[model samples]
Target: MPQSLFSRMVLILLGGLILVQSISVVFHLRERDRLLFRSNSMESAQRIADTLRLLNSLPPADRHKFVAALNSPTLRISLVTPPSSQPRQSPDGANQAASFGMMLRDLLGENPPIAVTVSEMEWPARQHEVNAPYRAESIHPRQKTAFTVETHLQDGTTVSLDALPTGQAFPLPPRLLLNLLILLAAVIVLSLLAVRLATRPLNTLASAAEKLGNDINSPPLLETGPTEVRRAAHAFNTMQSRLASYIQERTRILAAMSHDLKTPITRLRLRAELLEDDELRVKFAKDLEEMESMVAATLDFMRGVDNPEPLQPMDIMALLESLQADAAEIGHEVRLQGIAAQPYPCKPTALKRCLSNLIDNAIKYGKSATVIVNDDDKQLQIHILDHGQGIPEAELERVFEPFYRLENSRSRDTGGTGLGLGIARNIAQMHGGELVLKNKAGGGLEVILTLPKPITSGSMATKTGAASNIQAKKPRM
Candidate 1:
């Protein structure tokens, strides 16, 4: 999954999503804490300012009695004897304390001089050195502190407002964090699905191209997906159509020409029969017969190469033995060795015809051939070893060209149209395999027909092209 383009894209997108989500979570929590804490501070400032206003409204004698009335669990207003020079800041060292002080001053008005000091009860003025080590961000919304306000009244009595839990602090809500996590997961899953959808067409197109190489008749790619994908598919289909048409047309022309030539050669043979000169008549008839046979063989070769056979499952062992028996019957020395151990899907007739051609070449030249099949998971290697005087290394590939016999090495009678190897190679390639030629270690030629196993669901093309090794003298034909 990770190797696929779609999977890689999904992983990349998921990484970015995770990074963005992490950043969002951090920012959201920090912002939530800030907003909540600021709100708590403003509330604290309001309560303090209201207490001071009530004290100012009360007469000096009534201030002490009203002080107890203003006292609550969150706030305490007491009459201190005298004002102090310094007051403690809140234990929570956040700037909210200063902000609260400014807000309080704004509400109280400038006409009366009001001094506000919010100090941490946990770390009091004289105990700053001792409790400073414990100063940390409070998890709670309520600030834990002592708010002591000391200012002289007109009668010299100091009124103080002390609030407990004076610090302002807030943490992100658990519910909000949970919702963010759920949303992140949902988006990530959806992103993966979208990436898969986008890349699916590319995989299909690639698979179709591979199939097309093995079988030009492979089904056309489905011309549907995004607009860009559809356009590419349409072009691919058009190319396939042109290629298929071109191959069929060429095969048809070869067949037509062969048929037309044979008719003329047949008429010539009849005319030769009516000749009075026996020797000349015999020569003309012989030439005409050769011409007719050559045309027929050439037509057969073309048909074999361009066969439109579909792949079918067949046992390699059975095919090899069958070919061996056929060759032996014809006085050809063909030996069989090692089984394929399993059946593989292929164009049975094409593969059989290909093997027959190679074996025939081996018997014709080397006088004997050895067929050996060896296979692994990915490919089947069928080696045909011949003991003939192998062609020179430079001319090995040239021998497989149609009508390209080495007259010096190959007798005209035996090298039938010189299209056997060429046709065999075409058949092998149609099955997605290849033909390879190599000189045997000792003497003669070794032909390796490397056929691919089914890639997954169906037969693959075989090697694009073998001959055997034997120590026997050439056939006395």
Candidate 2:
């Protein structure tokens, strides 16, 4: 249930590896147990057969003396009276006894009837209870397994053999567990590295897409890596190239149309001047001016669609001061406050134009403009406030559309072509920033231009400067 592809892949690979290792270990243990059982059975049969041969070769009284030498921890040999009936055994015990009997007969070379029975024996039990020669006290109490073999010798004497398998195949040693852990750790580390490598291309593609949104002219993705990655990068680069071409072509066409329309407007203005009636001439000139203005504004909007200006670091406070000075020269009231701690990366010409439009709108509508700058490592925010009746909530966003003005009178004196906010927002988005408008609490409009700081911006403390309200006053005549 990992959210990331890397974590999911690692989980699946590790889970599969752990599962396979478990199965492999199980099969390995089972096979080892099987081989060990065969080896132990053969060894036990040979030992019992050799003991019988020795007993047959020796005198009857001496056979008892050899019994002590034949006895061992895993195997014990003794003489006993023949049982009156066959021994009872469980299903699994019966299978084991039958297989062992076959092996014993093969070793002995005689087809004598061998009564073999496997039984579960608890620790500290009396050896006489199951008729085993002796208990295997060296084995752990948990094992609790014993086998009894009774067969007749050449002299009609019955010999009893007890065997306790070593059970070496089941228990896992500490060293082996440590080795398995080490191997698992190594495999997990390698899997993480491989998954990261495989998913790295996706990260690159996403970054490229974000950069593309900010600047169409941003560098293309490098067509390197696996075949699929290369193909994707190539496609993205192709799309970017096509989009850039389309924007350039549209700008060119708009510029040409603006030039062509201005020629007829100029001719018409000259013809209007020659009219005999002054009132009619004034009306014609005004109409011609409005048409020329609309054409110029349309072209400007088209140009703003894509500005190829390269980004560079600029002092934002200096730009604000210059704008304030320009407004003062025009007899417009402008106030400035706050300081930028560091230079911000932006298109200097485009940014200056964006700020100029907002400040001009504030002065024209609100009679005065107050610019407050809030700068930090993360982003630079410039808030332009005005002291006019705030716009209605419904018309706030509608005013951003090109040529859509709130002044239904359509008088140039009341509101210039409504493309200022649109062009300004376009420039902000080009720099990967945002511009938003809000109604101030104190009966005014507030426009906030938020520009994000680059990752490498320096860490510096920004201090608020004393507010300087500049007003242009006409000199005394």
Q: Give the candidate number with the greatest lDDT.
A: 2
What lDDT does candidate 1 reach at residue 184? 86
Q: Which residue ranges in model 1 land beyond 4 Å of their true spot? A: 1-8, 39-181, 225-227, 265-306, 364-367, 375-379, 388-418, 438-445, 453-477
Each model's number of backbone clashes? 31, 0
Q: List the candidates' TM-scores in order.
A: 0.64, 0.74
Compose the digit string of candidate 2's lDDT tens values, residues 159-212.
888877644444667988898899888988888898899989988888889878
RMSD to native, candidate 1: 8.7
lDDT digits (tens) for residues 300-383 of candidate 1: 566654567766667677777777877777788788888765567777766777887888888878889998889888888899
Stretches > 4 Å off in candidate 2: 1-8, 32-119, 125-143, 148-162, 167-175, 270-289, 365-367, 386-401, 404-413, 438-446, 456-477
Q: Cα deviation of 241 in candidate 2 (Å)?
A: 1.8
Q: Best candidate, TM-score-wise?
A: 2
lDDT scores in order:
0.72, 0.78
